[model samples]
Target: MSGPHAPAQREHGPLPFALPRVTATQRRRAAALLAALEAHYPDAHCELEYRNPHELLVATILSAQATDVGVNKATPALFAAFPTPADYAASSPEQIEAYIRSIGLFRNKARAIHAAMKDIAEKFGGRVPRTMDELLTLRGVARKTANVVLGNAFGINVGFVVDTHVERLAKRFGLAPADATVAMTERWLMALFPRDRWCDVSHMLIWHGRRACKARLPACADHPVCRGFGSTCELRISARASDTDRTKSNQKPGSASRAAKRR
Candidate 1:
């Protein structure tokens, strides 16, 4: 966290990128959270597997409301079949659905992939657009998807990614106000961190969320980051324990539900 890739230093004054509502205190707190994430999950990165920009774009589109694992499981064959944007543009959406039927919202994802690929082939000369505005013109590529592509595929960092995990962690850690919308959350995060570290910030926070600060229950009572954030998580922890106990009592030992948490 203290080398060429370190967050920009501006501790003596207001952060230049911060929005009007952001205070210097919040910026400092945000820096601590960023450090905690780095300390805990230093190798955090985009989980979606891809060999090229188009592949990443499709994988991201398929990832909507779907798990990265699920998308990864389906992508090998899909990528093999349609190796390029032109391949997808040449085929019909129905054909695309055949490869991704296992993914959630396969039909809609198929349409998005088809339309987006068509756009890339016809509009962008078979290359995924690099800028946010350009990427948004393609179907299924909203802000989150654009951030993922811009940060991971092209090594650009224009905004913070505000996915479910980022949103949950942002609120729990008080990075953004509790009532912040997705766009507002992104803005708060962008304001708090430097432009250069924005990509790293999103990856680290997402990794922390998936590994510890989960939506249903977190696994970090003793973890330093949770403690540093002034976590009020004991109530939820106790509630989960009680629910787990009830579930165990209700179900027989070694049942299928035994491994499931009280989600």
Candidate 2:
């Protein structure tokens, strides 16, 4: 789980662009990393709860720019009202909007969901399309949603799903370069990890990213892989440790002793 590349030895002693070839050893280490993460996040299933493919698709449509918890909150009633693609297609945009208005961009999402459902019911016989090409034919179904549904619901990993957390974590962990675009990042990840691990890895990384390694202030000191990558993370860990020491020194003697014992 060391850095993907090593520093180059030059006139200045070491330059940063000396990328190592992808050896079998490195691949094995990467595989170990995958295994470790899988062990830690075993229950890392899709947070968007759904009974079937259609429900998953609808939930995913509602999940854009919105938290999964919020989407889940609104989905019970929404799913009850429009239990199928045909049900959503039959309803008006106004009716859908009224239910999911708490979510961001509800008005447009209502329209997209309704339009997508109409397309699905008419063109695909009321079942969510199974292939990437077919899924893309829906109005709001981009690569992200298509990948989620295809991978989780249909056992297909046609493409990597690069969401915001994935993009941030990929850059931070040196899985991809800092400047890599989402499409490029996805390609890099797919190439690095095995295809069969894609679905589980995506969810696990996302869960880890949100819970342990946040964008603003990742708990890198507590992260097992934090030492494997990132100059920023190293500094963050050092600073966090220093801050903890300072806070401990300021605490009452008994409390400080308890904290020290806990540490």
Question: Which numbered prediction scores highest in lDDT against the true structure?
Answer: 1
Query: Per-model C-alpha lDDT, please?
Result: 0.82, 0.77
Please give the TM-score that candidate 1 achieves against the real structure. 0.82
Local accuracy of candidate 1 as per-residue lDDT tens digits, 162-259? 89999988888878888999988998888888777888888888888887877766776867788778654645677899999897788876674655
Estimated TM-score for each candidate: 0.82, 0.79
Count of backbone collisions within predicted model 1:
0
Give the clashing pairs for model 1.
none
10 residues in a row with least lDDT, candidate 1: 1-10
| lDDT at 256, model 1 | 46
Off by over 4 Å in 2: 1-26, 228-232, 235-263
Score residue 53 of candidate 1 by CA lDDT: 80
RMSD of each: 8.4, 11.6
lDDT of 2 by residue, 1-263 (tens): 00111111112122222333455764776677677677778777678877788888888999999999999899889989998999989999999999999999999999999999999999999998877778888988998999888777777766777899888777777777788888878877777777677777788789878887787777866777655545255675678999999987888869867877999
